[model samples]
Target: MGTFASHRLKNIRTLSNQVSLNGYKEPSQSHPCEKDRISELPDDLIHHILTFLSTREAARTSAQSHWSVNKWTFLECIKLDIDWFHLDREKFCNFVDKLLLSRDNVNSPIDTFQLSSHAIDRASTWLDLAIKLNVKVLKFSEDRRWEPFYLDPNLVVFSSQYLKTLDLSNAVLDAIIFDQLNNACPALENLMLSDCLMEVQQISSSSMKNLNLIGCSFIKDLSICSPNLVSLRIKDQRMGNSSSKNSYLVFGTITLIDASNVEIMELSAIDSMFTFVEQDGSSPMFRNLRSFRLGPWCIDDNFLPLRRFLQHSPMLEMLFLKLSVTTSEPPSTDGETRQERSSTAIGWLRSEASRPLITLWPREKPLPPPPSEATIAAATA
Candidate 1:
């Protein structure tokens, strides 16, 4: 036994000597991998990879030392959705604060920056940073639980020349902001405002091609002048009957004055009033219009406005009308309503020479049956 033990010790010593001579280290003494190939990637390439991930995920990755400590600042696109924070407002705020702080030294332009959060009041710094970065596409949305988020008008003074597209939701806007946008963002193309509180009376954009306003209220008089606009959509949300004057819902007048170049227009002002003011004595002619959608309110006042509006859209090829039927009445006994609609249709056809394709959609709690053969024949006749 003793002889065997001595022989084993001698063999081990001989093996160690051979390893030293060959300059070969044991696997246990060396790193699992020779080098971190991932970390060795170029900063720009790593930034591109981080752009595909959410802001939270990117921050976590950076914390793990997979990339440079400040590699996230090199990202061209930053999308931070508060939903990922699971209502942890403090954590979300901290993350955003740290992110902007880390990019303080970065002069790189951000291609896109989108942030959706409930606490928009704390996002002024974020917006400032975005503007400073010369962000091209910026979208800021707030939770609709409380009052509309009020944006600081002073921030609008620092107009970003690189801003091309802007989208805001559940915010308060005024004329100053619009004027600033028109002057600052020369390349602005698309603008969208949804569920916003409007304090502005006029929205004039020479460079804008697409404008969308949904559920925006509280303007005594509103006028839109976008000669280069190709698409416009205005929709109003249904509001309850309340005596409170401070309610966000208020009926207002809207005028589309210089939308002659519009190709597609969707107007839904069921609660507010609308008028198409002509440039001169002539009607506001939509020379390039191809698609038009009229909401239930279009049929108000016996569809007079709709008929008159159709006269201007001579090139219109498609028309969509949304009609609401009273569910309180029996579906099979809508004879009066059908007759009234048929007569209105006949009047419209006689007034407008263009024979555009018309589609009617009925909306209510209970779905109404399709028009009977007789009803269709009568309408066609």
Candidate 2:
């Protein structure tokens, strides 16, 4: 076996040198003593080394020898960032197709598959292939230049029992896709949905441990029932253009039916009408919560809800209050002036004396001294 492996490796090195002439420059001929020691390694060891290289680098190296083609098949991770393809959509698709086709006979599982592309018409096929390969960590997104891509969530046939993490950005999702995720991906632990269009009314999962929903504008209500969830973050709007209208209305309430296991939670840009619902009346909502962050939009003129939320979290240790300047002034009303509202909010902040409070505000505005016992900080961004 040792002799056979050595001979195979030698043949691969010779082929690699010939293939390298296609695009990459060939190295100057050297004495046999100065030849690459890497080429002398066993096939398995060479494949292990190739796995550390980027997809582009691996492809370039594989072109140098016909034997190196087998090394690419042993790769467990594939990341095709199409930006490097120079926006050649057809060429990118063809390359991916050929790569997968070549590995059609290989039964090795793909540990990670991340693809960022502008051409998403064939995304379903690629996802199907990844599922067939038993992908564990899957991240799919369209290029930043285009609007959010609409994907048929049902198209994701998650036959892979090994799937643990899923991240989808700038995509459209409906109730069916959420249902499929809950039923198909039993091993899913972490899920991140960012800047996407959501048509689902409820997002429930039993196996999920961490859930992040950021800049999802279309979700009207969140009904999470992940009993294993330890961390949760929900942000209603994106940073830029706060005035931009969404296709669908923002969530009015977040129903934590079975989220008593959650330990850390963050809420940002939540409208005043939004509230929390605990299905179980016997237990307090967020009993395990230790860290809580309330974004600027989460607190409007009213501080009662914010105060009530903090009061429920008895074991809370770290508290973050992100305050932002509203671009437009509130319309004059006979009920209460802006100054009064600000004063009332400040009074509520002073009342939370038990926890360590960290106040975060924009950098453009001068940082005021710490309020009484609270710590004043600026936004890291």
RMSD of each: 13.6, 6.4
Best by TM-score: 2
* Residue-level lDDT for 353 in candidate 1: 56
What is the alpha-carbon lDDT for the whole of candidate 1? Answer: 0.69
Residue-level lDDT tens digits of model 2 in 1-381: 367556555555554444331254566665566544555667767776665566666665676544545568668888887776677777778778866766666666788889897856888778878878888999988764577777765566755578899998777787777887887788999999877777776767788999988767655565777889999887655455454233454455666666577777777554524466745445667788766766654445476666667767776655666555454546335465444554466566667667545455541343332232122222211
Tell me, by lDDT, which candidate is best: 1
Worst 10 residues of 1 by lDDT: 14-23
By TM-score, how accurate is candidate 1?
0.77
Residue-level lDDT of model 1, residues 1-381, one tens digit each, is 356445533433433333321123344455476554545667756665665555555555555345555887767788887776676788788777777767766567788889888865677668878888888999998876656777877654438778889998888887778777767778899999888888887778799999988777856688888789998988655444422222577668888888899988888666767787766776457878877777666765566778778868877776767565554533224344533563476467656555676766554322123334464445445
